[model samples]
Target chain A: TQLLEQSPQFLSIQEGENLTVYCNSSSVFSSLQWYRQEPGEGPVLLVTVVTGGEVKKLKRLTFQFGDARKDSSLHITAAQTGDTGLYLCAGAKNTDKLIFGTGTRLQVFP
Target chain B: DAGITQSPRHKVTETGTPVTLRCHQTENHRYMYWYRQDPGHGLRLIHYSYGVKDTDKGEVSDGYSVSRSKTEDFLLTLESATSSQTSVYFCAISDMGQGKAYGYTFGSGTRLTVV
Candidate 1:
């Protein structure tokens, strides 16, 4: 089984600060996805990077997939209170099932 | 936002009781999945269905069973509810080959607690 490990299990930052979360794995994946989950709600997909060395941006969020397809990173610029939530990264091989990483909980305060 | 709905957003039951969770999709996607989210374990797949009457186990399928009788509905059942099964459950749907390989849309999620 492919295991995805996320760094900084918890992060607390003040508003306007920049932070980066990392997701690493030894096994290669066909696709990689990032999601944000809030309290009492299921995770919402932020982006899906299919190719190696791919980069996608959504507003203040930037996602980058490693060239090896074995790692990914999420960078949030000027994080606000709205960015506080649990961030998760999932890797998919040939199968439909996603191998989820140990999530990173972010707390952004004003 | 994935045309998916999970019934009984929150439920509390006693041990050894039977419980069923329903996931309905309006998009008529061919792939459905059930997953549980815990504090430390993140999200773990319990079961998934590729088509009607076709189901398969996931990483944590023990004590849980799933059924898909039609293209739009999937059911998950727990024969005997256990405290360990208490967690937030999520339902997701994908569009066969394209959706599965690209990404998945998740439901609002259901919170279950077994005492």
Candidate 2:
């Protein structure tokens, strides 16, 4: 099975700070997706990058996929308390299954 | 936000008992997935169905079984609950495609605890 590893299993930062989370895998993927999950809720899709070297932005959040399609990164600028949650990255191969990363727990204090 | 709803948002059951989680979608999507979420492990797919009565196993499908008798409903059943099965279960639905473009919609999730 393809495994995706996320860096900094847990992160704690003060408000108005900037943080970046990384997801890496040895296997090439057809696509990659980033999700943010809050407590007692399922993950919500943040962005989906299909092409290699693709970049997408949502408000203060930015996402980028590696040129090799095996890695991705999420950067949050001017973080706030609302940004605290578990962030996950999932890699999709040619098959229907999606291999999810270990996840990064972000805690932004006010 | 795709009209996905999971029944029994929270459940606590004894060991060696049967438990079933229901996922209902009003979008009539052709693909449905069941996943378990735990700390450190993230979310692991248990089963998925591409169409009615068509199912496939995922990476962690050993003790989990799924059934899809209709286009809008999927069920995940545990024959005998175990402590290890205690986790939050999520249901996701996507349109008939490669699941890259349309993106999947997830339910609120059901938290199951086996003691």
Candidate 3:
């Protein structure tokens, strides 16, 4: 079984601060996806990175896939209160099923 | 937001009882998936359906069975509820086939508790 581990499982920061969460794994993946889930709702896709060393930006969020496809990272610029949520990283091999990382819970306070 | 919907937003059942969770989609996507989320565990796939009447087990398929009778509906059944099975369930749909370049759109999710 493939597994993805996320660092700094819990993060608390003030608004305007910058934070980065890392997702690492020993197994390589064909594609990786980042999702942010708010309380009482399912996860929403933030971005998908397919190429090694590829980076994609979504507004204030930036996602990068590692050069080996075995890791990924999500960086938030000028974090806001609204950015408080659970961030998940999922990696997929050659199949449709995704293996998800434990998760990172971020809280941006005013 | 994907047009995916999960019925019984919350449910509570006793041990040894059978329970079924339903996932309905309006986008007519060819793929549907069932996953469970826990505090430390992000989301674990339980089962998925590729097409009508076609389904397969996922990483955490034990004690869970899925049936896809129609393209829009996927049913997950727990033969006997166990306390360990309590978790938040989510339904997702993807138009692109599995491992495609696209991501999945998830439903609001259903919270199930077994006592």
Candidate 4:
């Protein structure tokens, strides 16, 4: 079983559409990070949330860390073709190592 | 994958043969990690290092072994390759010095196929 479970394993949306992807876990984390990965490339760091109940916005994307630090959500507005990729969430607990979620594959059609 | 480098971007090996993947970093990060990415499984940790000569197993560390002899190099080896072990491997580096805010920088990844 994956420590971090991501919802909507596969997502297909049209350009300009909006959607939210969720990462959930029963265990709390000290730090959580979001990443976007393109085909034939490694994952690129998107954002990191350490404080509980913290929210951050990156251009058209919004990320929120759950109050319990066991969940997180990423919402993208006005999705574009460039936003298409595999999204992964990783959580760090007491150690320096990170546990990654199952990942969500997003396809935004223009 | 700017600061980190993974060698042999692609490789094909026969079952039962031993294979080794290399991860070299110039950033001097204190931590190095190895992960395998598979469909439906995302990326699963194979092993990781906290410092030179210090390593530990990860979620899916079976059939794999790691060694970190220096701060900039972490190596992952598959003792006996199997078709089930065929997957894309990624190397990641991390350092915890930015006021507790932490994130990982990953290598471009190595595509390994076991025939």
TM per candidate, chain B? 0.95, 0.97, 0.96, 0.95
The deviation in Å at residue A80 for candidate 2 is 1.3
Q: How does each model score on lDDT?
A: 0.91, 0.91, 0.92, 0.92
For B1-115, candidate 1 gives per-residue lDDT tens digits of 6599999899999999999999999998888999999888888999999899999999999999999999999999999999999999999888854332467888999899999
The 10 consecutive residues of candidate 2 chain B with the worst lDDT sum are: B95-104
Give me the overall lDDT of model 1. Answer: 0.91
- Clashing pairs for predicted structure model 4, backbone only: none
* Candidate 4 chain A minimal-lDDT segment of 10 residues: A90-99
- For each candidate, what TM-score against the reference? 0.96, 0.96, 0.96, 0.96
Query: Candidate 4, B64: how far from true, in Å?
Result: 1.2
- All candidates: CA RMSD (Å): 1.4, 1.2, 1.2, 1.6
DockQ of each: 0.57, 0.65, 0.74, 0.56
Candidate topping lDDT: 4
Q: Deviation in angstroms for A79 in model 1? A: 0.7
lDDT of 2 at A75: 97
Model 2 DockQ class: medium
| Predicted structure 4, TM vs. truth | 0.96
Tell me the interface RMSD of model 3, in angstroms: 1.2
Tens-digit lDDT track of model 4 for B40-98: 88898899888999888888999999999889889999999999999999999988632
Q: Per-residue lDDT of B1-115 in model 3, one digit per residue for the tens?
A: 5599999999999999999999999999999999999887678899999999999998899999999999999999999999999999999998876554778899999999999
Report clashes for each candidate as comma-separated counts. 0, 0, 0, 0
lDDT of 2 by residue, B20-50 (tens): 9999999989999999988777888999999
Query: lDDT by residue for model 4 over A14-110, one digit each (tens)?
Result: 9999999999999998888999999999999999999999999999999999999999999999999999999999998867778899999999999
